[model samples]
Target: MNQLELLKKFTIIVADTSEINSICKYKPQDATTNPSLILKAVELKENRKFLNKAVEYAKKNGGSKKNQLTNASDKILVDLGIEILKYIPGYISSEVDARLSFNTEECILKAKKIIQMYEEQGISRKRVLIKLAATWECIKAAEELKKDNIFCNLTLLFSFAQARACAESNVFLISPFVGRIYDWYVSKNLISTFSYNEDPGVTSVCKIYNFYKKHNYKTIIMGASFRNIQQILLLSGCDRLTISPVLLKELELNNTVFNRKLIPPTIFLEPPRPLTEDEFRWEHNQDEMAVQKLSEGIRNFGKDQLLLEQIISKLI
Candidate 1:
């Protein structure tokens, strides 16, 4: 078997793009999307149909300009998710508006809205994972969302504190960005190249994995945003790894032998006392890399979201 098939024995592979063709070709167990991916996908000629449908949904709803645009923007996500669900049997991760990342109430509302859109289309809420940024407010928001049976995938997760907080909240999953963290270190000229064990991104996820396994935390750790095939190979036994189509193709072509590196510990320890909001903030802030990346990630996603809205507005 090729690496992709072998890796599947341990980790659940997820397609990280909004492109339907790639999802069909690679056949990942699950799929994830963000505004940047949706923006790129919507621009493609083949995906123009989804845009038209979203625009019509907004117009038929008959709201103010702002309300219509909001509805249209959300419609695009639901439309894409609904389509992806046809190809993959597992859950689809649709992220909330990045602009609402820091607003707990807004985050919760947006999450519910996404869920409602999916459910209205005859898709069960069980097939959807409402994604949110790993901000303190969003984490707190996720805690409440769980009561309504809304599972969340916390992105922009770089610090261990965020992982701890997510576990405490008992979120369904957490997507730690492996590539983004590696990119930060590279930009600083920290290291040009290194072995898998020395890679900061791999180490971060491993640390989180061990923590969860040792303490018997139920939250899933899906290693995402990989930079290379080696990063994916190193995280062979992660709960899930979201890969781009290009890398999936590479994995399919390569017959490299790799071992499962992550295994659950036999003995479980009592989880530590949950961290207070102040502690999570302080610990997360102390990691310069995490602080900068989380801010930049939110800003980048926000920009793409505005651009997506603009594209949908033109159609309306």
Candidate 2:
């Protein structure tokens, strides 16, 4: 079997793209979209119609065409998300503004707004997973959103503490980034071959997976941010994995045996060690890689979000 099929044997493969055509080609069980991905898609000739329609719709609905255009962009994003969802029976993840990571209240408010937008289009909460950064404030926001039956997919996760905190709060899903971990190790000159068991990213997810399974947390684990096919293959049997289209294509073309590398329950039968917020904060504070990357991820997402808003404003 090709690597994609091999990975499928062990995990639910998600196509990480906003391009409907690319998603249709891979037939990923689930799909994820970020502002960055959506921005990229809107720039495409084939997908430009979606943006155009958004502009026209906005012009008709509001104070100015510009204001209308912004609304249209938001509507178009939701429409594009719902359109992508039509191809899969599984869930589609749509992220909120990374800029609001520190404002739990704003995050909750925005999440509700997005859900309402989707519902207005006949999309149900079951099919839409609101994505948020794994900041403490975002986690608290998710807790409130979860109470409202709004499921969440916590993204930008980088450490065991973040995973543990999410599990404790009972989130719907957690996306522990994989490729970013590899990036850290590479930059620090820590890359080394393992006997299919010691890849840093693989080990990171395994740690989180075992913790959740052993403790019986219902929050699903979805590994995201992949750099290579090996990283995806190594994480087979994870609850779900979101992979880039380029890597997904590589997986589909190569013949590589995929195996169940992570069985959380069997692997983590011991009781989960308890963690206080103080301890969690301290642990994360000491992990330079996690601290640096989490900050960097938030900054990058925030910058892109700012740029997107600017683009929307100009068009409005």
Candidate 3:
């Protein structure tokens, strides 16, 4: 089997794009979008109509631009998300604001608001996975949202500790960043970072993947933020992976053989022990890498969100 086929055994491939057509081409089981992807889509000449309609909806439902509409950006964001979902067969992960990552109540409220908007558009809760940062507050919100039967995709994950906490919480999915991890290693080592399979980011994901498989945790592991094909191949057996279009096209062109590298049955020998909020906190505090990555991920997402807001301002 080709590498993609091999990866499919243990991984559910997810496209990371706002272009519904691009996602259709790869036949990924699911798809993911963020403010950055949506921003990129709005800039594309072909998606102008999508952007325009969202703006129109905002005007009608969001009131005037001078008097900001509560959750207006989220409304538009979800509208665009619904459009993207039309082309895929699986769930779409829509993220909450990075700024709200620290507020459990606010996160829950925003999540409910988004889910309501989706329902208004005839989208079922099952088809939507609310994405949130893997902070303590976000986890708390996720737990509450779960009780309401709303699934969640815990994102900005960088450490085994973060993965452990997410698993303990029984989140629907956890997106462990692969590319950002690679970036860290290279930034720290410069040119030497180009070495073959020794990428630290790839190793990090493997560790987390094995941990999840060993414990047989229900929380699905979805690796995200890939930098190159090498990282993707290294994580062929991960539960799911969100790949950018650029990388997706590269995989199609190469047609490399993919095989399941992670066998949970082979690796996990102990019973699963879930972590508590305090246990998660202590573990995260000890994981310097997770702390650094979580902070960096938030900052990066926050900057992109600001840029997206600026773009929306110009459009309106």
Model 3 residue 168 CA deviation in Å? 0.6
lDDT of 1 by residue, 11-67 (tens): 999999888889999999999999899899899998899889988999999889899
Residue 4's C-alpha lDDT in candidate 2?
A: 80
Worst 10 residues of 2 by lDDT: 265-274
Off by over 4 Å in 1: none
Evaluate model 1: give its TM-score.
0.98
| Worst 10 contiguous positions by lDDT, candidate 1 | 189-198
Off by over 4 Å in 2: 57-73, 192-196, 266-276
Top TM-score: which candidate number?
1
Cα misplacement distance, residue 186 of candidate 3 (Å) = 1.5
Cα-lDDT of candidate 3: 0.80
Separate clash counts for every candidate? 0, 3, 5
lDDT of 3 by residue, 87-136 (tens): 88899899988888899999999899899999998999999999999998
How do all models score by TM-score?
A: 0.98, 0.91, 0.90
Give per-residue lDDT, candidate 2, residue 252.
86
Top model by lDDT, which number?
1
